[model samples]
Target: MDRTVVSVLFCFVSYVFQLASTEKNVYNFNGGWETDESKMLARPGICNIDVVDVSKQTFSQKHFEDYYAYVKPVIIKGSTDNTKFRKLCEKTALLERYGDKIVRLSSANTHSYSKRDVELKKYVNEIMKPQTLDTLGNETYYWFGDNDYVEFADLFDQYKAPPYKLPNMHGVYSFGLAAAGTGVPFHFHGPGFGEVIFGRKRWFLYPPEKQPSFNPNKTTLHWLMEEYDNLHQLDKPLECTINEGEIIYFPDRWWHGTLNIDTSVFISTFLG
Candidate 1:
């Protein structure tokens, strides 16, 4: 082959690669899975346990030790001073501050977490999007859980942690960003307090030992679509919507799930 011909082919290949690398995935959700019954239930508003708001109370050491640590959950309103943290999480700040940073996103399909790494700026532009019925919580529905805490340490430092400290326990910080209309399946971990910086997050929770009927392989939306409306009144999970500045203190080992009711930014302090 002539030198000129080889050079042209090389240039074409480089241009193609650059285009592919720079392109982001658009979240064009698939819809049309709603049935009359499903729409009526509207994400299984039935069988829900009431989440009590305790935002006004300042807990003493005894209060946390006796009740919130082991036996029950509580929703604390105005629980955090995150004005600065919320400002950093604004779409533009994140895009500029961490545009080149890699973020790990979990697949909402199954119980075990499967992660995919994406750039912060790319995610806001591409993957983070509104949910639709059919593809709710599926691979395409980008739910940005598992924050890179260390990477955002400065931002996390700006946010306040709940003051109540448990004996032998220390707090670990985590933060996440997600669009409205999606969630994960029921799962549990060490007790922690989760707060919404902005937007609304609806949570469904169950006690630790109860182990409510759920499929590990399915997404939360899958359950809402197929079983939420049909569930007996007695089986409905305890539910609440934590709006801006609201916090939910989840007891250790308690099973819980979340659905973003609005484009949301949130942080959690897990105890160890």
Candidate 2:
């Protein structure tokens, strides 16, 4: 090869490597890269519910207040047209394109067992039915893995931040096929704001105060199972069956769990 051609090729390779490095940083650090001045500003008022179209308005403090009040953990009838959202949810272009890059959960470790332990495992098994425990355990539960930017870029571009804000709001959303006889273990979000659950399962909500000993930070996988055993001792926990077209907003810092009595697909969006 000519000396000049060799030098040019080396320079081109170096530039390509630098570009790849920068792209990696941008995707991995998305949650920390952007901070908004509005998030830090304080607004005072107990959260309440106002019947407003979420699709039309940007979620503000007033909306948050209303959401905290009547709608939090309560079903919002006609909140979203199921037909429209269903199309978005069913689009498999992104998943098909980036499936190999996505990460799966490690299922090797089995935590301590409780009375409810069998139910929790059974639920997970049902979702990934026909697949062995090892395969399901290794599957990823989160839609946005380390490279979430690639996974959800198109969806974010179309919908924007009104529903799913990135970085600051954690942009945590998940979709799973329904599993009969399975339920999520009781748990609470730490810096929890609210969650919108859409599915065909029966969801149960419990106030944080009711589960006095439940630790949001330290509650292990096994602890959630144990919590279910104590459910009979407490007053009937608020129970609601979540269905398509209905969005349930459960406020932050509340202890909640779900039991999927029938097979269904569910999506949960967390908002701060």
Candidate 3:
């Protein structure tokens, strides 16, 4: 063979080998966290067990010691009065001023304003547009309207029991409003707290143990939807149509989502 031809062949082979090496590194970097497999296993004893009814019992230190390690989530009812809740809901001056604008979930269903729901439908329609998922970043946007967070904190301050300190900071206690004929996209809470949904909406909760397998490096929403779709049959979700003054507590790491049956406003508090 000619020397020039031999040199060209050698260069081609070297280029191909370098490309393969780059691809392998990329795969390994992405898969390293996913493949360990054991972290995803559900730890059954980590949640604090307490009665869901506030009239019955509040979450005490004793309750935390006994069941906190084993129970993953708990929902509490009868935590506050309706009149106070209504007052907070009515205090959405910022939201009303913002008109129809919000940060929306990626790939969510688009709602129409003229769908016979109510005036709130226009606001809902504006917020549910598609966007890309950036890992749970600190960028906060209004789910309902601008004042939603303010109203939510006010309600949380009034309703949360003693020792459940309301944060002096904004966004600690937040409000979400869902219009009729829509739902919040599936998602999980951030670290250090669970969520309390206050309103008359149907909520669905999925436990990690119920999943086929677990992947701890990933968020709860990923596992919950995977199991929910594959299982085909939903375990009867803890469904509650919370009234004006009622609140439901879901412990941290509990996978939850909601659908709005009616135009609803809710205040969610995250307790550390």
Question: Number of the top candidate by lDDT?
Answer: 1
In the range 1-272, model 2's lDDT, one tens digit per residue, is: 99999999999999999999997664333222111223211111122333344656565546555555323454454444444444454415323443344333322112322211122223333323322222222231311112244555664344322242223456455444433333444556632222222324555566777764443322222233445456465555565654445455666666665544333345566654
Model 1: per-residue Cα lDDT over 1-272, one tens digit each: 99999999999999998777654111111011111222222332432433444465556668767877787777776545777777777666767788888888887754556778888777778887666655634464463557777787777778888776768989887778776666767889898988887666778888987777877656666676777678798887888777677788888899998776656677888999
What are the per-model C-alpha RMSD values against the true structure?
16.7, 20.0, 22.1
TM-score per candidate: 0.76, 0.47, 0.46
In order, the Cα lDDT scores of the candidates are: 0.70, 0.42, 0.42
Cα displacement (Å) at residue 144, model 3: 5.1
Q: Which sequence of candidate numbers ranks them by TM-score, best first?
A: 1, 2, 3
Largest TM-score belongs to which candidate?
A: 1
Stretch of 10 with least lDDT, candidate 2: 39-48
Global CA lDDT of candidate 3, please?
0.42
* True-structure RMSD for candidate 3: 22.1
Error of 3 at 5 (Å): 99
lDDT of 2 at 193: 21
lDDT of 3 at 46: 18
